[model samples]
Target: MIKRILLALASGALFAVGLVVSGMTQPAKVMGFLNVAGIVDPARFGPWDPSLVFVMGGALLLMLLAFALTPPSRQHPERKPWLADKFELPTRRDIDSRLLLGAALFGIGWGLVGYCPGPALASLLTGGLDAGVFVLAMLVGMALARRWIGRVAA
Candidate 1:
């Protein structure tokens, strides 16, 4: 348990640092990078930022490596995670209305504010008002979504 907690802390700190260093904590940078439509139009390409492409690509590569490396805990008890006893993975593979609504909401929020939950929380260390407000709003939205999605799913 202690090892797992420590590993989680270390992982979170590293993620926060990556968010800051990758310019993800900056709303303008994120907004610029998210402007994919502008990239297709030469006239509107000025606001588009391509720097984030590398960051996302590296993340995807790392995730692919990790997923490919990890095996089923049931058949590989000796190869379980170093920090935890077992993997707590999602077994559900089928997509539902809940998944669609959640993804839509996430994309809308990111496009409008350029602050996903990770970067928004990481930006709080810089004492930015926008990040603070965004985090607050995100929390409230999460609460509302919990109750709302529950009803919808039922």
Candidate 2:
């Protein structure tokens, strides 16, 4: 348990540091990444920042490697994580309102503030006042969404 906890904390800290170093904690960096139109126009939103694209590509590459390396066996069908005894992945494949709403909310929030949960959390920890506000609002939004979704699902 102690090992798992320490591992988790170390992994999270590494992720946070990566975000900071990659400039993900900066709203302008994200906004510049999102400025696809600025790529063609150049005068409107400045040169499109392609650093985030590289970061995302690297992450995707890692994900593909992980998936390729550790795919669960169909014959066994009882895959378990190394640290945990049982690992149950989300089985839902059907696209429902929850999925749609969640995606929409995430995109909108990211566009509006340029701070996704990871970056927001990182920035908040690094003493960014704007990120602090964003994190607080994000927490409130999450709680309200949880209550609403629970009621709806029930």
Candidate 3:
């Protein structure tokens, strides 16, 4: 349990660092970029704020490096434990109303909040009263849904 707590804290810290470094913490910047205003005020930053491109490139590069460094899984390992497992795609083909409704709800929430689940949690940790409310409401919604599902299943 202690190990899990430590791991969660470490992961949260890493995510917070990523959010800060990526400028996701700044809603104004994201909103401004979305607005597409023609002002282009380069004077404010003065060549220092290459936040967007650098963040994306760095993430992609890191992912590439990780994939390259990791060796391919072997079916029959020379060691005790086998490295490979059976792989298969989802067999469910039906696009039920639940999936569409969930997607629509998620989109509506995101459009209104400007903070998705991960970033909302990050913002709550980093400091945002709005984010705190959002997280609480999100948890309530999740709990309600789970209760409803349990009742239905029962």
Candidate 4:
């Protein structure tokens, strides 16, 4: 258990460092990336930021490598390394109204705040009020979602 906890902490620290290094912790950089109109008209909307694309590409590459590295499961022989085991994998019924609603809400929040959960937590290290607020709000939102979702599922 302690080893798992330490590994999780290390993983989180690495992720936070990556977010900061990749410039994902900055709202302006993220907003710039989300500026689709800026792609066509840099003068009007400002230059389109491709920072996120590179960051995502790097992440995808790493994920592929991780998937390649993980050994195949014995019980669920057909399952891909990247995917959950047969018992853990969600069914089509799991993709319900709540899932769609949550995804839409997450996208809207990301667009408006320019900080997803990972970057928001990483930005906390900068000691910025905005980042602090965002992180707090994110935690609160997560707690609320857990409560609500648990109740709904029950």
Model 1 lDDT per residue over 1-154, tens place: 7877888999999999999999999999999998887777848566578999999999999988886786657667545564556768899999987789789989999999999999999999977999999999999988998898799779
- Which runs of model 4 end up more than 4 angstroms from their true locations? 72-94, 143-154
Top of the candidates by lDDT: 1
Per-residue lDDT tens digits of candidate 2, residues 56-149? Answer: 8988998687656664555546654546656677887899877898999999989988999999999977887899999999999999989988
TM-score of each: 0.83, 0.84, 0.63, 0.79
Error of 3 at 143 (Å): 0.8
Please provide, for model 4 over 78-130, each residue's C-alpha lDDT reduced to its tens digit, 9 standing for 90 to 100. Answer: 53533334335555665768878989999999899899988988888976899
How does candidate 3 fare on TM-score?
Answer: 0.63
Q: Which stretch of 10 consecutive residues in model 1 shows the poorest summed lDDT?
A: 75-84
* lDDT ranking, high to low: 1, 2, 4, 3
Cα RMSDs, all models: 2.9, 3.0, 6.1, 3.5
Q: What is model 1's C-alpha RMSD?
A: 2.9
Q: Which one wins by lDDT: 3 or 4? A: 4
Instruction: Give candidate 1's whole-model lDDT.
Output: 0.88
Error of 2 at 40 (Å): 1.8
Pick by TM-score: 1 or 4, better one: 1
Backbone clash count, each prediction separately: 0, 0, 0, 0
Candidate 3: stretches off by over 4 Å: 1-9, 31-58, 76-94
Model 1, residue pairs in steric clash: none
